[model samples]
Target: MPTTSTGSKSNPARHDMSVILVTGSYDHEIRFWEAWSGICSRTIARTGESGQVNRLAISNDKRFLGAAIHKKIHIYDIGSASSDPILVLDKHTNNVTSIAFNSEGQWLASGSEDSTIRIWDLRSPGNIVHRTYENGAPVNDVIVHPNQGELISCDQAGSIKQWELTDNLCSHELTPAGDVPIRSISLASDGSCLVAGNNKGQCYVWKVNDESTSLPRFQAVTRFLAHNKYLTRCLLSPDAKYLATCSADTTVKIWSISPGYDFKQEKILVGHQRWVWDCAFSADSAYLVTASSDHTARLWEMASGETVRQYNGHHKAAVCCALHDGAS
Candidate 1:
């Protein structure tokens, strides 16, 4: 279990979980933290020649960590800490915004600002499995289906496209009638629904069916004006029972989604002095972690809407964060 700390600003950032990774805008470094003690574990500075680190993705086994910088993807071997990435993939023509590894750790997908998505095979060296494109907006986020070989991608146009990884073809396109650009996308663990957050501080839930046809269809289950400001990130609980969203409005909300996927606002967590940029849930769904422009990351109790602890050490804004259980 992770221990709670009650110290002042003099103390280092605590690491309650196994490993914590943070990406900063000004520093251009991906800093690792010891989860329970809030201590700086290691700092992986961008290679002497690379641009700022924009995003991060850890493999399912926790043996590898991927960082997106400029138009490249840097893969680091976290099994041993040398601060140097083992492989640097420079194929995207524009800034690589998001990357995700499938549950089996066999495939890796990267979404770029160039309006393209690339799928790479982990088993083969320098092998590109699939490459697909969306109409012409930066592909901001990409997520693989929980149980199938399909990929879901979202962009600045608030449209969702489904691509079949094996065939390297876009199977379907889902454009919600409105024009709010989607900032983030997340799929439930059971693969029953897909949730998207937009720039208008709204979240939309869609029921997805795989058995329907080649072009999978979606039905709008609910739409929530979650906050007064733009939404930055959204995540679904491990059990697919709740959806958590963070926004520029300086609040994080947890919404109940089970038994019919209703958008009942259960709790609104607040403490950050600036925009809440990112939020995540623990593996067991017992805790919530948030990264903000306030130069601090906070851990909150999911049920009580109380901030359990705060990790404040970054001199600048903590743009992105990832929680690693360190199973490997």
Candidate 2:
């Protein structure tokens, strides 16, 4: 069942059974908010060279949370009361841009400005790198396929690369937008569709074929102008019924997805004063939480297109958010 924010303090010690609504900001702090109440229930100080969080991901089991900082990652035990990170992963040579946990949460995949994608084995003694894939340009986003046998990544050079786990090779490459930075990518949970958002504020959709081979083929479905300014992130709802795109235009637009990958405008979430950087959908696809450079994060009710809650505690730009409501 989807967890509700009941105006109570977040019990980090009970994370596995509680709702998690976390946002990371340039203020050098990560804040956990009571989703519905908009209360900042917990805060953790982050200090480093960059002092800004680029991305955040919660393990599928809700046992751990990962924060991507400059050239490193901080992994936190969600059940712990300590404010310090349980493990610090320092492998990337440049800013780590993105991070994601596999379905089983046994490992984490990270993409970086270092031009590489690396998998960290959480089960290993020191959480060592399990595998690494080299890209020609700075990586922006990376995600694991639902089958856990492939990885897909997009880079600053606007190229999409698919790496096969068994062969340890890049099986396919596509450049939908030439030479422009592709900022984000989202794969449908069932692995049937892929969406990439670029600096030009355009989004490319593809139909994925993943059933027969280790390497999936992508067929161009459609391309559309998602925003007039840079598109920071594009995420497919967990239930695969909608797509959410946040941009430098200061708005988050929701698109309904239909058969054959047709998309129609659904809602325009407007409230942030600065760049809308990231967003995460609720497990049931009924709600969306967005982070913005305005130093706040807001929860939007999809059906009504209204801001249900506003989380305000950050002193600087809030760039990334992670939410796990235990319904997966």
Candidate 3:
């Protein structure tokens, strides 16, 4: 027998009820937001002297959150009440700028101003740090190869280096120009393309070939000037349809990824009053989250170029963000 009700309200937010969004900034705190609402559901303190979260990464299983901080990577349980980290792995001497987990959650990689790239075996008893590879300059960005056992790192001295995890050495290096520091690096969804942005506001593109071999080759596909000011981050949508870039010019630009890595400018997102530091795409790539120096993080609808929600709890600039869509 069914109980009849006069009326029932529809729950539109149920689809993203379990989605997680963690925003970090210079305020020394990481705030987790409700997916559909602009409300901060949880806030955790994470910082040391001269250290705020420069980057954030979530494990593939969505069970752990990793924050890249000065000289260490703090691992926290996503569902825990305690603000204390479950693990603190320290090996870096300078501030950690980037951290990411492998697709299988077995390895964690980090790059830092310490001028080193390291991989940690998460399955080990202490999550032992592996062989340290020197980049000769402060590494600004790190990208894990989709092939599982490789890492591509870019440094402040304009070197794109590929490290072979099997041989524990650098197999190849790509230098577009001498001494132009690269700010960010991103890989296309199918692993066919690699793109990097530099402090000079130039973007470089390469078609990844022979990746299945021991020596992967990156052939330069295209190079273009992107922004008037420094580029902060370049990201490819998970769906492979768009490449999004944030810059010191205070804008996020979306570009279409056409054949042969030819990019066509699709839209320009404008709202932030200051530098745009970071951005993350929703699972469907229909929406984007942008962190800006204006002390806010915004959710934007891709089609209309309009902000749908503004997250406004950070005391200072929002520098980094990580979004996990549970329904995807």
What are the TM-scores, per candidate, against the unseen true structure? Answer: 0.88, 0.94, 0.92
Query: In candidate 3, which residue pairs clash?
Result: none
Best prediction by TM-score:
2
Question: Per-residue lDDT for 34 in model 3?
Answer: 74
Model 2 worst lDDT window (10 residues)? 7-16
Ranking by lDDT: 2, 3, 1
| Maximum-lDDT candidate | 2
- Model 1, stretches more than 4 Å misplaced? 1-25, 47-50, 127-130, 212-216, 326-328
| lDDT tens readout by residue for model 1, 201-281 | 878888887665674477778887888898988899887888899999888899987678787889989788888887767
Ranking by TM-score: 2, 3, 1
Q: Write the per-residue lDDT of candidate 2 for residues 50-143, one digit (tens) a residue.
A: 5578899999888899999778899998878678888888889999999999988889999999999999988887759999888979999999
